[model samples]
Target: MHLLRLRTDVAELLLSTQGAAVLGWSLDTDTGRFPLLRPARHDGNGAPDETAAFPLVPYGNRVGGNTFSFAGRDYQLVPNAGDRYRLHGDGWLSDWTVEAATDNSATVALSHTADESAPWDYLARQLVTLDGYRLTLTLSVENTGRDTLPFGLGWHPYFPLTSRTRLTAPASSVWLEGADHLPTEEVPLPANLDFRKKAPVPARWINNGFEDWNGCARIDWPERGLTLTIDTDPIFSRYVVYRPDTARDPAFAGDWFCFEPMTHTVDGFHMPGMGGLTPLRPGERLEGHIRLEALALQTGYQRATGKDYPGP
Candidate 1:
C-alpha cells in the first residue's frame, strides 16, 4: 500500500493509490484531534465499501437493469456488484498512475479502454491539494473513445455518523428509494428528511438521492467537536445520503454513513432528467472540484459555518 500524506500546520490528509481513496482526514487543532472523514479500511484496490471515500467517474450510482438508451443506441453495462447493477465506474477498481506529487499535493491518473467490462473509454484524473485547514480535490474525466458518450463525476465519502451528527444541504427535492434500492420517484422534501433547516440524520435506515443540490453540505460531530464543511464545484448537482439499518446488514453496525456528492442522481441515465448525464464529444473532458474543510466547533458556537458554495 503506497500512502501519500499531505500535512499543514492545522490539517492532514492521507491518500492511497489503491483507489485514489482518502485514507483519512483530520484536523490538528488547538482544541484536539478532529476526524473529518471516515478512515480507510485496507490497502487493496480501491474498494468503495471499505475505503473512506473514492471517486465515481464516467458516472455514479446505478443505471437500472444495467441498460440504457443513449443517442438512439441502446447500451448495456456489466453489473459489478452481484450482477444487479453497474457500480461507481472502473476508475476506483483500477490502480491509478501517479502523474505528479509534492509535499502537499498529488495528481493521479487512470486510463480505461472500452471493453466487455465497461462501455466507454476514458482518461480520468484526481488532483488533491492541502492548503491550511482545507483539502481540495479536483476530479475530471475525458472521453477517449471514438464516439460521443455520456459522463458524470462524483465523490463517495463516508462520513462518520454520531448521535449528534447533523446535516445541512438544501436541495430542491429527493428521490424515494425503490425495492432495488434505486430511485423510484422524485418528491418534495419531507419535513423530517428536509435539511433546509439542518437536521440530524434519522436513526432509521435511509438510502435516497437529492436533486438540484446547492453544491455544499455540512457534517457536524458534536461529541468529537469536529465539523466538516463540504463544498463542491457546480458540475455536481446531486447528492446521496445513506444510513443502513443494522438489521438488514451486519456491516451496518459501523458508525459511518455516506454523503456522496454526485453529478447526477442514482439511475439518472434512465430517469426523465437523464440524471444530469452530460453528453461528451470525443476527446472532451469533464471536470469538477470538491473542498472539505474541518473545524473544531467551540462550546458556544454550535452553529454550522458552511455558506452557500456557488455552482456554475
Candidate 2:
C-alpha cells in the first residue's frame, strides 16, 4: 500500500499504514531541502526499523529473556528483532487502519489480542498533526483484557547523522548495557555521557538508556544549516540512544542515529527501580505526545551586504 503524505509550507511528511509509522519528514528551505528524520529506505514489506520513525506502544524496549512475572502469574513472550528478548511491541509489527486523514493531520488505529506470541490485549491509536513548523504525534493505548498488565508508551524517531551534527540533552543517570543487551548497572552521568554541550555521536557503539531525561533535545546539522528540536511529555522520562555497529549492520553505518524517547529501560521487568512499567488495569489507558520543530540556520552572510547575523 502507498504511504500517506501530509504537507505544509515548510514541511512534508510520509506516514505508513503497516505500523502507522512515519516514513519520512523533510524541511524545505532557501539553502536546500533536508530530511528531519531519516528517509524511509524500504517499502512497507520491510521491518519498521527501516522507516524514519515508529510508535513504541503497549511497551517499549525488551522484556528480558522473553518472560516476566506479573501479579503472581508468569507471562512468556516471543523474541523479535534478532534479540533473545521480546522487542518493541505488537503495534509496530501489526498493520494499522487509517481512521482519518486530512491535509495536515491523520489518525491510525490498531487492535491486538492475547495469544501465543503476544500477551497484552489492547487498542492503540496514533494521531499525527502538523501546524506550521511543528509536527505533533499523540499516542494512546487502552487495555482490553479482563486482567491487568504493565504498560508503557513512547516514540522511536531516527534522525540524519552527519559529520557536523551535534546533540544536546540533559539527563540524571544512564544504564550501561551488558552482554545480553540488557542494562548491567545504573550510574551517574559521566563527562563522556553528557550531551549538555551538544556532543557528536560517539565513535564507538552506544546502546544505553538515560533516566530522568529533561524531555527536550536539540540536534544541529551545521553543514546543512539546520536544527531540529524534540519535545516529549513527562511519561517519556527515559531515553535510549543507539547507533548500530558497522560490522553488524553495514547498511546503516553512520547514516542515522536513534534518540528514542521511551518510558522504561530495556528489560526493565527484571529490575526494580529501572522498570517504569505501569500496572494498567482492565480498561485503563496510557498516553503521551512527542513534538518536533525544524528550522533552517543562517550559515551564510546576508546576500545584499554580506553581513552576519545571530544563529541558533
Candidate 3:
C-alpha cells in the first residue's frame, strides 16, 4: 500500500492508495495539533475503515437483496467485506492508482470492469487537497459500461466524538431503517434525531439517512476549543449519520461517529424514483465535492454562536 503525506504550515494529511482512504487530518493550533477527523488507532497503515475517511464511488450504501432491476435489465452484486449486502460499492475495496501528488494535493484513480460480483463498468477519480485550514475531497465517476446505469458518489468520514461534541445539520426528513440496516420508510425527523439546532450525538444506536439536507453541517468540540464546518456541493442533498452499538460491532467505542455525504439515499436502487442515483450513459460522468474547514474557537466561536468560549 502506498501512503502519501500532504502537509502545510496550518494542516497535515495522510492518505493511502489502498481504497484511496484518508488516514488522518489535523490542524496545527497554538495550543497543539487538533485532530479534525478521528485518528487511526494504529499506524497509518491499516484498513480503509480504520482511516479518517474514504470515498464512495459508483454508489454509496446498500441495495436491498443484493439485486436490482435497472433499465429493464437485472443486476446482481455479491456481498463484500462480510456484509449481508454489497456495501458501499467497490471503490473502498479496490486498490487505487496514484495519478499525481504534491505537497498539499493528490489524485487517485480506479478502473473497474463488469463482472458477476459487481456488474457496473466505471472509471473513478478522487482529488484531495488541503489549503490553510480547509480540506476538500472531490470524487468523480464515469460510466464505462455499454449499458446506461445509475451512478452515485459520496464520502464516509469518521470524526472525533466527544461527550460534549454537538452537531448542527438541517434536514427535512429521515429514513427509518429496518433490522437489515436498510431504509424502510421516510418519516419526519424525530426530536432526538433532529439536528436543525446544535445537539449532542444520540447515545443510542443510529443508522439512518437524512434527506433534503442543505449540504452543510457543523461539529463543535467545546472541550477542545475546536469547530469543524462541513460543506458539500449541491449534488449532495442526502447524508447518513451512524453510530454503532457495542452489541453488534466489537470495535465499537464512543470515540467516533460517521457523517456521510451522499448523492443519493441509501438503497436508492430500489426506491421509487431511484432515490437520487443519476442514470449515466457510456462516457457520462457524475461528481461532487465535500469540503471541511477546521477553526480554533478562540477567534470567532463566541461571536458566531453567541456563547462564551469554554477554554481548555
Span of ten consecutive residues with least summed lDDT in model 2: 298-307
lDDT per residue as tens, model 3, 193-299: 99999999998799999999999999999898788889999999999999987888878888899999999999999987899999999999998888888767544
The whole-model lDDT of each prediction reads 0.81, 0.83, 0.89
Query: Model 3 shows how many backbone clashes?
Result: 0
User: Over all chains combined, what TM-score does candidate 2 have?
Assistant: 0.93
Better of 2 and 3 by TM-score: 3
Clashing pairs in 1: none
Of 1 and 2, the candidate ahead on TM-score is: 2
The C-alpha RMSD of each candidate to the native structure, in angstroms, is 4.4, 3.3, 3.9
* TM-score, cand. 3 vs. native: 0.94
Candidate ordering by lDDT (highest first):
3, 2, 1
Clash counts for the predictions, in order: 0, 0, 0
Best by TM-score: 3
Best of the two (1, 3) by TM-score: 3
